[model samples]
Target chain A: AQSVSQHNHHVILSEAASLELGCNYSYGGTVNLFWYVQYPGQHLQLLLKYFSGDPLVKGIKGFEAEFIKSKFSFNLRKPSVQWSDTAEYFCAVEAAGNKLTFGGGTRVLVKP
Target chain B: DTAVSQTPKYLVTQMGNDKSIKCEQNLGHDTMYWYKQDSKKFLKIMFSYNNKELIINETVPNRFSPKSPDKAHLNLHINSLELGDSAVYFCASSRVTDRFGTEAFFGQGTRLTVV
Candidate 1:
């Protein structure tokens, strides 16, 4: 079975600090990757996705993810993070039949 | 206007009771899905319907069934709910386009607590 692993379970950072959440998957085929964010008391929303073409994909709120096929990793990054960026981030991989296998999720707390 | 909506944002019930969670999408998407988020915040797919047809059933229990009356509506019915059924159920829809992969839009989850 395919699985996604997010190394960071919880991350705390001050405002304006850089952010990077590591995500690795166990699959060796044409794959689609995504990063979703859930704000406090809100539904999950897509931050970015990578199906094909460029490995580096940019998303809303200055979020970006790079799909490194060789490493089997798609990590989410941001040059600077704000307090509003505090949320739980999930990395998901599209498996056979379009089913998504999500990671354990990483909760980010950005201090103001 | 909300794109995807699920009714009864919070549900509290006793074990062995029957309950249902309603979901509707106004995005006009062909594919809709039901996902459960456990207390640990791990999200897993429970069922998926495309154009009112069952597409993916992730080995879910028979006690839980999904009904899609149309392309825009998918409701989940639980029979004899158990204490282990306590979790947040989310309804989401995605437009399956040839050019791009499916990007799901989620609704405010219905948090169910079975005592």
Candidate 2:
């Protein structure tokens, strides 16, 4: 069974602070990784994804993720976060023809 | 335009009753899925359909069933819902592209409360 782990359950930071959410998977295969964000009272939307090629992938809303295959980790990061970045972030991974397995989400609260 | 949508944004029902969550996608994607988010905010895959065919069925109980009437619609029907079945159910869809960069578009989840 493939599972994802998000180390940070909740993070609070002031505006312009750098953000980094750690994510690790327990799978060793051709895996596809994704990051999804859910704003207050909104549906989950894709932030970024990494299948192959470049390890660092950029997404909407100034979000970026790096897939480190050696470490079995795909961590989300932002150089400067805004108050509007407050939301729940989810890290998901899926194998071929398999369902996407999500990690326990991390709630981020950015104070302005 | 909303690409993916789910009906009954909030469902409050009694135990032993039957309930269904409807999902429709207008993105013309070939794959759709149902996911459950528990109190702890842990997301779990319940079922997945591709091209109107059941593809992935996790270790979900038999009480839960997913039906796909067409390529763009997938509905979940729960029989004899129990108190433990309370959770936010989300529907999502993705294209069949071989690349892994494609992301799944999720619907506004249906929050079901069993009392």
Candidate 3:
């Protein structure tokens, strides 16, 4: 079974600070990666995704993730963050089927 | 308009009770899935149905069953719920196409609290 690991469990940052969340997965075959975010009371929404081709994938809200096959990592990064960026972020990987294995989410708290 | 929706957004029940959460997707996707978000906010896949057929069934207990009457609807029924079953359940749907890799759209989630 494939598994995902998120090194950061919680992150705290001030407004305008750069943010990065580490994500790694264990899968040898071709994989699809995704980053999903959930606000305080909102449903989970897709932040970004990496299917194939370019390793760097840009997503909504100025967020991006780079897929490094050698490292088995797809880390989410943002040049700058706002107070509204505070949310729980999840990293998910799909190997063959439609089933997505998600990592333990990382909670981000941004101070304005 | 909500793409994917789950009924009874919040459910509170007692142990040993039976409960069902309904999920419907207006996106007309071919695959639907049920994921359980635990207290620690770890999302785990429970069941997945593709085109009204059961495709993926994780190590979830037999007490929990997923029924898909059609491609757009997948309902989960839990029998003899326990305290450990208290968690947020999310329903998601995706279109499986060969050309493009699709992403799953998640529902608002049903918060199940068992006493």
True contacts kept of each: 0.00, 0.00, 0.00
Give the alpha-carbon lDDT of every model.
0.83, 0.83, 0.84
Model 1 regions more than 4 Å off? A1-75, A78-112
For model 2, residues B1-115, the per-residue Cα lDDT tens digits are 8888999888999999999999999999888889897553546678888899998898999999999999899999999999999888889876623322233567767889999
DockQ of 1: 0.05
DockQ of each: 0.05, 0.05, 0.04
- lDDT of each residue in B1-115, candidate 3, tens digit only: 8888998988999999999999999988888889897543447678888899998898999999999998999999999999999888889877533322233466767888899
Task: Score chain B of candidate 2 by TM-score.
Answer: 0.94
Estimated TM-score for each candidate = 0.55, 0.55, 0.55
Classified by CAPRI criteria, candidate 1 counts as incorrect
Which residue ranges in model 2 land beyond 4 Å of their true spot?
B1-115
Ten-residue region with minimum lDDT total, candidate 1 chain B:
B95-104
In the range A1-112, model 3's lDDT, one tens digit per residue, is: 7888999877889999999999999989999888998665344667888888999999999999999999999999999999889877889887763346677678788888
Give TM-scores of the second chain, every candidate: 0.94, 0.94, 0.95
Candidate 1 per-residue lDDT, tens place, B1-115, comes to 9888999888999999999999999989888889897543546678888899988798789999999999999999999999999888888877633322234567767889899
Per-residue lDDT, model 3, residue A37, is 85
